[model samples]
Target: MAESTYTVTGMTCGHCVASVTEEVTKIDGVTGVDVDLPTGAVKVTSAAPVAEADVRAAVEEAGYALAG
Candidate 1:
């Protein structure tokens, strides 16, 4: 498995965390997710290779922007 961390901006509360988590968890290769609200970071564990574009799409669908 591999891990990736995405810096998400505009996550201001627990609801934001839940929303993002749910959105990201829907991705095909995602096996796990950890959201740190204070840091606005999301750690994703995957069983196989996952594209950054997919990750970015997920975050964007959740109504937040991923920071580069």
Candidate 2:
């Protein structure tokens, strides 16, 4: 599996985490998603390397932004 970590902005609670997780989990080949509320860290595991644009779109769909 391939793993990637992204910093997401505007995530403040469990609901935010859920929203982000839900959207990110929808990406093709995504096997898992884990979000750390305090650090705004999102870790994704997939069967193949996921595109950065796809991750950005998913985060935006979840009403958040991917931090640099």
Candidate 3:
């Protein structure tokens, strides 16, 4: 498995974290997602190769943007 941590912006509360987590979980190979709202960080665990672009897209789809 592969793990990565990304900085996500616009996550102000628990609901924001949940939204991102839920959306990211839908992507294939995504085993787990841990969203830290206070720090705006997202930790992801995947069974296979996962791209940063994929994670960014997922977060954007959930109404948030990946921090540059």
Clashes of 2: 0
lDDT of 2 by residue, 1-68 (tens): 99999999999899999999999999999999999999999999999999999999999999999987
lDDT of each: 0.95, 0.98, 0.91
Q: Write the per-residue lDDT of candidate 3 for residues 1-68, one digit (tens) a residue.
A: 99999999998888888899999999899999998888998999999979888888999999999988
1 or 3, which is superior by lDDT? 1
Instruction: Quote model 1's TM-score.
Output: 0.96
> Estimated TM-score per prediction?
0.96, 0.98, 0.95
- Order the candidates by lDDT, highest first: 2, 1, 3
Pairs in steric clash, model 1: none
- Model 1: per-residue Cα lDDT over 1-68, one tens digit each: 98999899999999999999999999998999999999998999999978999999999999999997
Give the residue spans of candidate 3 off by over 4 A.
none
In model 3, what lDDT does residue 51 have? 85
Give the number of the best model, judged by TM-score: 2
The collision pairs in model 2 are none
Candidates 1 and 2, the one with greater lDDT: 2
- Model number with the top lDDT: 2
